[model samples]
Target: MKLIKYCLILALFSPLAARAQQPAAPAAQAPIVLRPGDMQVQARSAANRPDRAPVYPGGEQALGLFFLEHIKYPEAARVKQLSGMVVVTATVNVDGSVSNPQVTQSLSPECDAEARRVVSLLTGWQPAMRRSRPLAVLIQLPVPFGTAGHMTVDQARRQPQR
Candidate 1:
């Protein structure tokens, strides 16, 4: 018993054991150094690339205005005082048409349906281009319901739920 006790004491107090108990120091990371032209290889001339993202007919502001003008706040959501963004996903075909619009994130059943309706009505979308060739791409749009920015207080009050 004494021998076992002595072995245990020795093992617990050993220098190697004490070192193992301590947290290890983190290794130093070398700073990344880039030469003046290190990034030039990855960049291509804009004229040659011609890669572009899809654009709405009028632009971002116009798109937002379109939504604000068209979105009908659901009566169910208005009664509940619900305010949130419903993400609607759709594909922009090569011919500038929207297809397969679906609600990716749901705020409410009524709000989701309303969002889909608005998104379905969208038109005149310039399709994305890669190497100067038009490409079909999926796009997600956030439809706001009963939100302060989207549905103005006056608008909500004036157009009470029917």
Candidate 2:
């Protein structure tokens, strides 16, 4: 008799419990469009120039400060006094994530690794916009040394990777 009563109670609440457990609707995915010369331009810059360049979350000044705070001159480099620019090539994705960091220019192996490490820490950029749509762009960043030598992200963004 008690089992029958419990079964009746469970049955009454099961629909409500099931409804609560249902997953929310997924977001719609955007369609990708490709035109001729797309890869060539993106291979060069945006696939083409952007309507608006990607902004580091706060701004360029903030980015400089980020580099200053995050980048560490490697101990070996410091000991050897090997100071020069470390050019890191990275993509600021449409999702505002930094990806594919590469050391296009090397100062020292230690410095290159350190520069890559620092660049990888950066995220949450205002993605590049083209025709009012978000797009990814390849960017070169120069992290300099000796305290007064580093270029700002704006300067770095405009620079071509070598």
lDDT per model, in order?
0.83, 0.83
List model 1 lDDT by residue over 45-114, tens digit each.
Answer: 5543326778999898898888899999989899999988899999888899898999999999999999
Cα miss at 157, model 1 (Å)? 31
The number of clashing residue pairs in each candidate reads: 0, 2
Candidate 1, residue 108: Cα displacement in angstroms equals: 0.2
* Model 2 lDDT-worst window of ten: 39-48
TM-score of 2: 0.61
Give the distance in Å from residue 66's predicted Cα in candidate 2 to where it truly belongs: 0.4
Whole-model alpha-carbon lDDT for candidate 1: 0.83
